[model samples]
Target: MPSPFPITLFAAPNTLCQTLTLTHERELSALKKAHSTELQTLVARIENTSLSTPNISTTSRTSRDLKRKREEKPDQDRAS
Candidate 1:
């Protein structure tokens, strides 16, 4: 059936638009109900994994050692 309102963008309630809205709402509600438990379980697993894992240091130990060597090099040359 043609739209009751002159323009498609108009917000006026039409049978076709109302039917489509109800159908979409029912589909979304069913999907949420079906997946809600699965989504919660997945989230819990992710949180547990993150908490159990140890934190890693971002700075490189090798860089610090190299810097110490460089600082000592000039002092050794002056003494010799």
Candidate 2:
């Protein structure tokens, strides 16, 4: 079966305004269809990229520092 894509054919010049208008509309429709497919592809890529990334959440520097310091400190008293 022939593909749905438009075929390039040479035709005599269309003199009627209505014929030219119809041709222009058809071309625009085909162009819109192509852009729609491209947009869908981009959207899928964006979705996949977002899904593949790690979800790790990071605390602020001060909170991380506090947590590390707390871990390093011991219960033993330093004073005599």
What would the per-residue lDDT of candidate 2 be over residues 1-80, giving only the tens digit for each residue?
A: 88799776466456466678999999999999999999999999999997887544533666788887887675334432
Name the regions of candidate 1 deviating beyond 4 angstroms. 1-19, 34-38, 58-80
Every model's TM-score: 0.36, 0.52
Instruction: Please write out the lDDT profile of model 1 over residues 16-80, one tens digit for every residue.
Output: 79988999999999999879978999999999997886544424566777899999999999999
Q: How much does each candidate deviate from the true structure in C-alpha RMSD?
A: 8.2, 10.7
| Residue 70 displacement (Å), model 2 | 12
Who wins the TM-score comparison?
2
Positional deviation of residue 47's Cα in model 1 after best superposition, in angstroms: 1.0
